[model samples]
Target: MPTEHDQPATHAEGTDAAPLAGKHPAPPCALVIFGAGGDLTKRLLMPALYNLSSDGLLDEGMQIVGVNHGARETSDFRDELTQSLRKFAADRASTFHTSQLNEKAWNWVVERTQYFAGEFESDDTFEGLKQLLSTIKTGNVVFYLAVTARFFKPIVEHLGRAGLLKEENGNFRRIVIEKPFGTDLASAKDLNAHILSYANEQQIYRIDHFLGKDTVQSILAVRFANALFEPMWRREYIDHVQITAAETIGVEGRGRFYEQTGAFRDMVPNHLFQLLGMIAMEPPNSFDAETVRDKKAEVFDAMKPLTAQDVVFGQYEKGPAGPGYREEPDVAPDSQTETYAAARVFIDNWRWAGVPFYLRTGKRLAARRTELSVQLKTVPFRLFRDTPVDRLTPNVLTLRIDPAHGTSFDFNVKVPGPVMEIGAVRSSFDYADFFAERANVGYETLLYDCMLGDETLFQRADSIETAWAAADPVLHPKDGPLPVHGYAAGSSGPAEADALLAADGRAWRPLVDTRKKED
Candidate 1:
């Protein structure tokens, strides 16, 4: 067992000759994963850490301690993780290349990884964990609670009681909390208050993996780094903003879990609202963590409270060979939980007083896609009204979040002939074309940021509460204004969703990959 004073010098302590030279490696830390044997641990968290290690971003003295209720040997844990990495590499072969996980990197990571079996609420388990942690000589610690919401409070309480949440000298303790922050506003507030009792605001990272995507983060650069777009980002020039997160598959096997967390709670408050903040927030004073988070929190605070009239819910019915939401294995036949959700949100601030922001997300939809589109108001083309051209389509700027991973702008272009016929042309920018593709599980950036103690991409407590407040009417309505509609499996969504935009004299942009089409 390595003592605190005798621990190996960290990657941060050595001369600047390693990979990413001149960049600060994370301080020596022990990452204690609460739900180590779960899918999230195998699928995302471990893969991300391996990639970071391959890139030499991890500290030399870093260690991974996985805790779970089931007892398993360290070698068994390593073998399972190895299999997961192999599967992840094959699954992401097209986008994130094969070089992400190699023999050398995998071996290096497994050597420092260990596992401990423990019940979340048991004092004996936590005491054993404390002894194991003391033997490791990690200066800083990160506690990642990847378990279900029910275990979050208990685990944190146990850690606090065990004195594992303490910060000594310059070393610190941070906790990464996975979401469904809470069911609704009041519950979310209660959860926040409880967590804050054990950790400071800066020490808590409420992660939303969507914000860690390369393109999602690029929203900032596109808005602030460029002078052309920011000037026109206001309500006067922009007609409305539409954010769509669609899925072709329903709850795979977690039907019981999905029943409690429908699309509104599952997608809207966390993932969709994170995108909303990126699109709607005012320019931050600086790019630092607190400054950026403050601006995003302000965006959530400015959102007008939603009413049942502003929202729509739907559930997918059984198609020819597909199972409906209730038909899934563990779900009840009369389940009223919504598998689809759509709403029109309004920010009360001056920059977007009248502009409506449309949000829609659903499972078993037409396509597996996530995108954000800004539709500019039509130009007052009185001069072209007399021409051969019919009504002009409004200009649109789209940020494709998944599958395509890029940005595209729709602009009118004249036909080559002398007729002056007008047609829409799409100009797109794909991330893969410009940068080298690397193995990324989306958690790489987020985990690295957490290790470096940067919370710029994470959600703040107030923001989470504010987002739930905005969606409360849709979740639990007093007047029963919104009806739960139905849509076919593999369809876009309910027709009522189209009516949501139609009522505003607008329509959703077609769900097509512009990269696959010609200009």
Candidate 2:
């Protein structure tokens, strides 16, 4: 599946690529999207690829071989893709005049489209896949295993046996796997080892879709590009950082899936930790794969391990006619799985010695919003003694990731009245205004990167383990009043969630509208 959260901006050819150096470039091969019949394939991957193809970026002879368990003809799949493109890709298409995309693109896409259905482990299916790919004669191939985690090992082994492993003249062969890589640290290692047997570490792409968003990418630029922020980005000047990925929708149809993976595994390990790494990673020597990955891995390794008391595990209780986590079908009657998680983590390093990194994610919280709030410490002494310093709420920088795309800062400012009163003001830098363009597809940019064989935004193998290493201690089964708090279905979250920070003398900022209001 495509990465979940990041969005990319569309740009004219010459003006676009120079600034994104070492980040994204086009590729020259066919992409085989497995599980093409699934939701991820129909909704995201196909639409994204079609948009990229329309943009004049996809190379000649590029093909997409979609693998599904069903018996849909190539025409059926093409029609589905055409409709999705019309719906999702239309905005980008119009902006770039990519709508003039004609039948040649459709014909190329449909002609290359074919399906092979059989047991993933069965060798009988290999011959069909091999024959279909023979005509393409492409050097690079990307196999996206959109299937469940259970099928990863078997598919890798079978693909290796099919002689698709390492061709004598092929340029590159890679595989992209989605998250929930493992339930815990030990299982993650075993899974990695198993997959590594067939695909080398360099050839594997473990996707955390959150990393794909445009705002997420902009975070790096926000910090390093400008001199105003990066110098004060450590313990000495900054007070703390809070990364929150909150969802207003509950597990409606994903009840069965939610039974196995709780908020911790689903949100914290991959998304929240990735955000933290971006917030804390040292400046890379250069933007190459090793340089970026090495810097991220260091931040992960320095994460302070949490004891039982430092963490808060909460399973949302039934609120106002809503069903609790345990009430969902196929879930344990008294499952300890937490739907809401809040914790304080420390990075024991020179740059961020004692500053606590607060991260939280939960379903059925207030409104759906993902944001990072960085609070810089205030000045030592206030010259205006009588005035309430509430106006000078420490400088806060917010990076909003979803439902809207933008960045806002809360800084102290002078009052305008002649009375000579002082107050603070909030100013924002919206990505939309900066680009003067409508938002681009998050998946489309990520798909373009994957096709180009760029692993900069994608998660590396070591970073995955390091993230789970920090998360494992709290997620592991432990004893105590492992509290579960409940808030109304449409409410933000449990009351205790507020208490989590209230006791520490902090509170969550009010949910601000990330998107511009339309009349």
Candidate 3:
């Protein structure tokens, strides 16, 4: 006899991570991965494929083709992928971590894996891919451009010229492009149009892995699914919303890339906006992919244009973490790029006309936390005005996204035998405490959804453009560069950001997560 932890993992053999019982495997398709030799392929794509295999979500007939510029034998490519997968499995620190690799599932991926070598701009690559895909059993195909931004257009065009994006015999053909869809409004529109020239909107999947967190996906369930929170979700009951995506690590060696794309454009427009859409969207009549996306798009469309007065920018100064943003390698000493940005946004709509939404993101901060907090307005009449309490404890409902996956509500409560004193207590719900864990790199569901032609989780062109439109004013402030304030790397952000909220007579919830721990 063995305890649950001692038993070997199995597919459909009654284990937590195996046999997605009611879920069916995706339709058979060939997953043609561009930039196969890159980090995204090994770090994310491979792990997602492995998880899909483990849970019996990947069709047995599915084939994987790895395309890159370098020459390598198919066996060598498979071996390298296997080694990478094993490294991720053995590392407890990794998202895809596990004590041992699933041999049967891994073997399935390796058996179906193939490799192709050709330059993205060269016609040879697309022609080679077209010929190789012809031999694959399934007519359905997914072209995933795991490469950099520069190659996005050229590769799509090459595929178009080679007739690789065509759907034949009633089989589906799709392409998944990773984001930074574009830096600003102009670039985003250009990119959208460029891609549409080669492939229709329905055939493209603009994926954002950052939105893959369980807490982010559960925003709808947290709101509409609960009667208590839905009615109080509008401008009337809520005071404001705070969206924070903070990281403790500075630009390691990507300072060169960071120099071009600042914190605001890098995050606020896409990741934060997508999360905002999820939090702010109206309840859809159905979860039909298009229906849900339309509601999300509406949120973006309603955003009031941002200006310098409503935004604050910051750059990290040297601290215990390491060198400051400018001192980092490849960064200019006089670089004006912002490492942190905070903005005051408004949705000029019926439900949330006057409500303010504060968003902030930074590379070096006191904590690495990504969460959304909804602080409700205080009661009109302070019932315990004569009590020991100076004022009511502000009611805040927090949906903690990464690092800590949970929902917590802070409200006033009576202290036991404390002479009519009121206290602030948090009633929290954690994913780990309530549900079984899964090996996820945030790419599993997006990959499966793409194979099934579900675009609800992915961004639409209109949403992307509208989100960029909201950030455009801030990105290109009419008056020279918005003054950049400096803060210690280990601090929350510049003091100016605090002023952004303080002016509204509100303050940010502390960066540190304060939750009572009970063993």
Candidate 4:
């Protein structure tokens, strides 16, 4: 086993002299992951830790212990993680992949990394954890449940029974839970109550990785920091807002899980709603952790509960790209499980009282776009009625969340001509154009905040419940006649989704690449 170094850990290259300015290591603590052998652990967590190490944001005294159900020695676990990290580094598709491994940083992360294997349901597993912690000598611990939802309550109960959750001597004991918090509103409340029975709300971090994205976090800065936007962020000036999360790939082999949790249950209440909360929330008085979270909670509480008529559901059909969702492995031949979800909802608060917020997410769509577009009300076109222009273009501010990391605004500009003419153009900003940092897998910031006791980016119990409540009626509609329409594998979505907006005399913006020129 490797031992902690007395000297400070080495900073990564590119600087080659000192750590990044204004960045420091988080507090020293032990991180114990429950599903240590799962794909999430190998694919995201290890790379995130490696990135934190590369940035000198992981303390030298930090210890990483992975607890999963299996029989393996600590050394073997370390070796397995080493292989996984190297593989992730070499793969170009992975979010945190680099051309090569930074051995200096990788070694530092691995030195603190260890493993424990025991059944999550057995009392002896947590007891073994207690004994292991006694030897580790770290006063602070963060138990990360990366396992399936079924294992959550039992594992928490075991931790409470073992008394590992008790904090003293000015030390901290906390837990980080992955989402799919519940299937519906009632279950979400029940889950929250059950989890809180053992741990205080302060000690629980209900993580939503979507909040960790740079562009997602920048929503606040763009709205609050910029003097150009705050005054115009209301129903009077803005028309309906659209939030779209499309994917080009279908359920990629997790058919069993997807069958149980369709697109709405999978994306809406947590990921897509978080995006809505960011774009639609009232400005917080300050940027304090609780203050920002409270603002988000208010936005969630303001959502008008959905109904069957307000939402549209769809499943992907065969197209140019690949097989239909039903043909995917492990799925039922006649599955009613919807692969697409779209809804037009309203926020009942004063600031956003009559403006509709449109949300849609689905698999195997025309593009892999996750975007929020705020469309301003169109200007009067009486001046251009005779100038070869019928109506003025609606001014739109688009925040692209995935693949493309940036913001862009569209408006009309006068074209050069002898006669009066108008043309639409865009002004855009992309992170890659101005920033030199590598892209992260979205877990780095969430994990770092947990170690430092920050809840600004995490979800709270009330927020979670309200989000679930907003989506409940559509999730389990009392009306059985609600139909699931079909769109091709590479199309935008169902025609009904288009109809949702067409009914309002509006249209969806093209799902073309933001950085590239559109046809």
Best by lDDT: 3
Cα lDDT of model 1 by residue, 1-519, tens digit: 011322333452222335465655566789999999999998889888877777777787889999999888999998988988887887777644773556666676778899899999899988999899889877688999999999988988888889988888667788999997899998999999998888888888898888878889988988999999999999889999999999888899988898888888899989999999999999988888888989999999999888877888999988742878888988988888899999899999989999999999999987888999999988765556344323776799999988788998989887787676777788888988898777777998898888777888888898999999988876678876367798888777889999989999888876654545755
Whole-model alpha-carbon lDDT for candidate 2: 0.74
Model 4 spans > 4 angstroms off:
1-19, 93-97, 385-390, 513-519
Writing each residue's lDDT as its tens digit, candidate 2 over 24-128 gives: 335556687777778788666765555554455555556678887767777777787777656554655643345544555445455656666656777877667
* Local distance difference test values of all predictions, in order: 0.84, 0.74, 0.86, 0.85
State each model's C-alpha RMSD to the native.
3.5, 5.3, 5.2, 3.7
In candidate 4, list every pair of residues with a backbone clash.
none
On a 0 to 100 scale, what is the lDDT of residue 186 in model 4? Answer: 94
List TM-score per model, in order: 0.94, 0.88, 0.95, 0.95
The TM-score obtained by model 4 is 0.95
lDDT of 4 by residue, 1-519 (tens): 112223333233332225457765676688999999999999889888888877777766688889887789888988999998777767854465456877887887787788888988999899989999988766888999999999988888889889999988777899999988988999889889998999899889998888999889998989999999989999889998999998999999999999999998999999989999999888988878898989999999989999987899999999976889999999999998899999888999988999999999999998999989999987745676355333666799999888788999999888898767777888888888898857488898899888878889989999999999998888777867369898899988999999988998877877765555765
The 10 consecutive residues of candidate 2 with the worst lDDT sum are: 1-10
- Which model is ahead, 2 or 3, in terms of TM-score? 3
What TM-score does model 1 achieve against the real structure? Answer: 0.94
